[model samples]
Target: MKKLSMIAAMLSLLVSTGSQAMGPFEVYEQALRNDPVFLGALKERDAGQENRAIGRAGLLPRISYNYNQGRNDSKATYLNERGNLHEDRHYTSSGSTLMLQQPLIDYEAYANYRKGVAQALFADETFRGKSQELLVRVLTYYTQALFAQDQIEIAQASKKAYEEQFQQNEQLFRQGEGTRTDILEAESRFELATAEEIEARNEQDAALRELGALIGVPSVAVSELAPLAQAFQSFPLEPANFDTWHALALANNPILASQRQALEVARYEVERNRAGHLPKLNAYASVRKSESDSGNTYNQRYDTNTIGLEVNVPLFAGGGVSASVRQASANLEQAEYELDGKTRETLIELRRQFSACLSGVSKLRAYQKALNSAEALVVSTKQSILGGERVNLDALNAEQQLYSTRRDLAQARYDYLMAWTKLHYYAGTLRETDLARVDEAFVRR
Candidate 1:
């Protein structure tokens, strides 16, 4: 009763003083702005944003200029018209033309533009998925730290109790009222408790460091969670029909949606390759001025302007176009199979996590009952020892059992929360707002 009262008082002080403790959502918000892993994905998403512009550029106008310069020399000899004549010609020749062309119809570029749109959407969805995943990771590490803190407290409490018992046994033995075996047994248990306390402190430190790394900060202090009783009193909502979760996974999962976009890109690839067999046409205009000296005649200078349409008809390629088409077709087929595979895999994961959450409530309930029983046994054993009907070992065992149940209960709650997060992820509905829902379960402290 005294230990329980002390724990309650400590909890009250912790709640009152830990106003600045970082909760899961608080850490998640920091990660959104600063976490290197998720920030890297944002940069990648930015890079991918240019896909549409690049695809659309192929359909825009292009303008260019060309220049040429040279010297010409010739010698001629004839026997009939005029007695053998010989001539030589040399001159600097240079000309420049500015040309402009516009593509009127480009099926390949059109298909590629559509593909670019899909790819951009895929990037956005991928980033959203990464953000949601970070939330769960933050929550997981936060809970672990809380559990570690509880373990340290339990270990310390047990160690204190054992030290008192050992001192009492030693005094009684010194007075010749206690057996030597009783003193030795009490001292051994005390040593074991000391070791346990050391281990629990180490675990607590490690958990704090892990949590700090997760939120991009050094380990300092974190807010204690709401009382476990309050946080886990109610079970999570369960799916009415398992098939409903499977359907939701297929339709809403962000990864699966990204894969669907990839499939769209592959289908467009087929269209782009098939376009190679179609005619290509461009309208062009240019103007140029040039001067040249012909050895057989006189020097001449002229300026000219021209405008025309250029057309290219693919009569044949050494089967290269056909090969490209086949490759694209194969890729499209591969993407289809990949999407199908992901759908099944996603459904399986959804069911697994869903089932865990469903059964976790029952497990939590059982542990709650077990903890009550353990506490009662600890109390009864102490009473029996006072009446000379039980040994110190019996009370120690009951105390240890109670602490074990507390740790298991804490772990089960963490698992329940994890499943809740995963179910939302598979359903493509996880978001920052969802973190608020989780926060409601944990009172600010």
Candidate 2:
């Protein structure tokens, strides 16, 4: 079993590099087939969907048939006036019956039908929430991998700059134009950069592993994202009202809606239990054919037919019915509390994501400016080095700063996208169509 589990895990990590490029939505479609958690929810949804039919069956007529074939033997002893007589007989006997019963007035069954509808609705909402959650999860994993890849690039660029600085310092020292201290500092910096490069590469690999696990692939490479300005400018977030978003969340959030259904079903349970004490009426019909033996030693066959209405009036039940009603009522109260809790949580999350999304635009702009300033600083430092106003080390530092700022800028863009998606998810407005614009934001690598 352990080996099989390992194999499954390994298969989930297998990568198909030859396939066409896959984005967040494309990967999610793959996860729908391979993600175990989502698959389990799908099965549960299908099973819950059967509740309506199951409940309907209870309100329909039930028909049954029975047949029997066997041999029967009999022995008899009798004492008369002055003599005793014994007789033995054996025969084959067969019987068959067919019956149908229909409930005329069953309050509990009616309540059950209502409960089934509510339960199925609850399952629907739950399943929808799971589906929306899949998009968020896939996007998160995909972006994280990209972010890790960026870090590695930054580290390698820094490493290269430091390597050049070290070589220059070493040559200057040999020519007596630089001090030994300069060479030592440059060498240390290069070594540190190398270490950073190794660490960053490892992080990138780990990130890819996580992305693979999510999409049931061993390895993956995400396409490069479009420049922030082009993407955001083309598709800007508008009508940023927190109250409006919160209202939408309250109205449509699947988790909260599912909880609402739960509460309704609980109310039905209380009704069903309360109705248990009410009288029940049913109509029944039956027909039977049997073989029998008479005292005269002759076999006979008979047919019987029965039809009647049955009325069951509850007189007393040792308080069991009342106790059941109380239990159901308590459960109903609990469901009400659960629904309230779900509503509160959904509102809180909606506010958080909405705030993030609303502010993300400005945040991206600020990060972009920061990256620009860093790049300008690197150019200015390089000119200063040429003029002997700054050393090679100063130019290298400026380059490192530029890359760091760029990475942060990229991170902010991704954060904004994530917040946007999560806000829609909270509002239960996320769909596959929402990804179309986002997909355009990725250029094929």
Candidate 3:
């Protein structure tokens, strides 16, 4: 009863504290702005959006201009009716040519444009997947820190209880009312609890460091979890059956969607390479102007404009086109295999999380019952010690059991919450709204 009152008082103090605490969703928001991995994905998506423009360029008209200006000196020898005539000329010559070409028929360019569309889609889906991953990662760190904090609390409580027992046992022994074995046992347990408290504090520091790295901070204090009764209220909205989750994953998983786009890209690559066997056709126009030529025509100026159609039929390219086609086909095969493997792996992961969530609920209930039983045992053992039916060592062990049960209950709570989040992540349904829902389970400060 006294421990319960103490816990209630601590909760009240936390609720009334003025200092702010970071919630998981807030951490996620910070990570969105600061996480290098997610920022890189955003850049990659922006880069992918240019693929359409790059591929379409092959189908567009192209224009080029060339100009040259130089002084030329030449001497020419001519033999006509006379024996020989020598001519010398020096002139400044300048010329410019402008040309334009438009593709009349280009199967490879068409395939490339389609491939670009697929690539852009792939990038979008990849970014979406990264976004979900960041949310999952932030929450994971938050839960780890929470669990570590719980461990520290449990260790401290156990240490304090053992210290009190040791002092009482030492005084009793000094007064010839307690055995030396009881005093030694109490002292030993107290030292072990102190060591455990130190280790728990270290684990908490490491967990906080990990969370800080994600959000680009040196350290952070996370908000306490909402009361268990309140946190559990969110679970009823989860899907009931495994089939529903599996279907959702198949339909919506961003990774799988990205891989499908990759497969389309590989298919178009094969088409682009295969089109190399086909003839190419282009329409071209050119304007040319020249001021001077060699010695004979040194004083002449001319301008010309022309339009024409060009055709190139591939006879052979030393088997380069065929090799490229073969390579693209091999790549397409690899993409197919990868998508198949990823689908299976995704389903497997989904199943694992689904199972964990279900089992976690049951485990939470079991641990809660165990905690109640352990608390009762502690009270009973202490009462028995007063009546001389139980020794001091039994009371110490009961206290340890109660603290251990508290730790287990705390861990189960975190595990249940994390498993629920993970299940949604694997289903590709995690979103900021999901984070909002998770935020309901945490105090703001």
Candidate 4:
């Protein structure tokens, strides 16, 4: 229990310190340090960098030194003019060799080196795609948290309006001017609003926790969006056409670029496997020194040096090389198909987001007008009640419509902002500056 309290206090401090209201870019910076996915990409990039060195090693000079030592025991018997003679001897022998080999014309090694180059390129582009994905993820969660907060605000406002209406109806009943049925209806609406408010709060908490988990914060609260009137003025689409966005996605989208590299890697893989059936050539040099005893030439030392060119011709590999080449060609075909699929998918998403941006602008305008109309209806309904043209229920319904319209208006604004960001993201132009621009739409609440 004591341990739990300390954990709770630490989390509380995290929330309090986060009171400064983090924008998307701020959260992204934290994620860069703490998010495991992004960190793993960094590590993968580092590991990929070694491929170049490893591939070049096959073409470079290779040197090695080896030493050997051994002991020998011998016994011999000989017959002489006088009698039989016996002799026994024990001795040690030692030898050392230094060797060097350099590839002169190895096709397989050359192909392998090229394959490594392509693999490294693929890894680099893959990491870039992951970086862009991180940006998208950060913005996604930030906007979700903001939307949840908006829901909470709208729910609270509804609950307050209904509560006031209920209280007014109760007073009217006490004065014998309102019916018991009217009071009961008001009571029911107020209770429903209260429940909605509770649900909205739960949603906001869940959203905050999700965002917090992403950025290694606990119970984070996002900075609220600036009022729509002020923020909308800054939210115009750049280049403003689906064609330009399509061109940009084709030219710059990191995932597409990475897939292209992957295709290149596959092509190189086919070449690498095909080269296995080719002959190899290498140049070799070696120096050796040896000393031996307990032989006819005992107590003598020998030194030798050699240099030559070596060639190896493949006769049969039990059809392994041919099979490998076939498999690699199949893989290359698969990569091509995958790249085609990705290209189509990317273009489809680009079109979808672009359409959203175009529609979002008109939707925002329509919702704004609807919100204005709803507000006017509430006022007119109240005035009508005094003129016997409306009832207490009419005013209550008008207020509810006003609140719902207001919520829709807010949601439209969020959708507009997100669409604009996603457009840039799909076009591969999303950057820290773009996030900063998005941040301008937010202010400390």
So what's the TM-score on candidate 2? 0.83
- Tell me the alpha-carbon RMSD of every candidate: 7.8, 4.6, 7.2, 4.3
Better of 2 and 4 by TM-score: 4
| Candidate 2 local lDDT, residue 11 | 51
| Residue range with the least summed lDDT across 10 consecutive positions in model 1 | 222-231
| Candidate 4: tens digits of C-alpha lDDT, residues 1-445 | 7466446544654664456555677677767765678889999988987787787788899999999988878776789898988888677888899999999998778877887787787788788888888887877777666666677777778778877888888898899988888788877877877777788777767767766665554656444322223346336777887888999999998888888888987888898888888888999999989888337645679899999999999989999999999999999999999999999998998898898888888887888889889999999999999898998999888988998887787777777777788788788888878887877777754
Give lDDT tens digits, candidate 2, residues 334-404.
99998888888888888887788767777878877888899899889978987889987687678778877
Q: Which residue pairs clash in candidate 4?
A: none
Candidate 1 ranges with C-alpha deviation above 4 Å: 1-19, 67-92, 165-207, 223-232, 235-243, 287-304, 315-317
Return the TM-score for each candidate structure: 0.80, 0.83, 0.88, 0.86
Candidate 1, residues 1-445, lDDT tens digits: the string is 7466445544543554467444577667656655677889899788778787887888888898988867766666667866887666556766678888888777887888888888887887787777777887777777767776776677677778777877888887899877778777767876776777688667767766665565454563644434333445544474666777777777778889889988988998899999889888888888877666344333667678989999888889999999999999999999999999988888888888888778888988998899889889989999999999998778767777887887788778878888878887887777788877877777654
Q: So what's the TM-score on candidate 1?
A: 0.80
Best by TM-score: 3
User: For candidate 3, what's the RMSD?
Assistant: 7.2
- Model 3 stretches with alpha carbons more than 4 Å out: 1-19, 175-184, 222-234, 293-297
Top lDDT model: 3
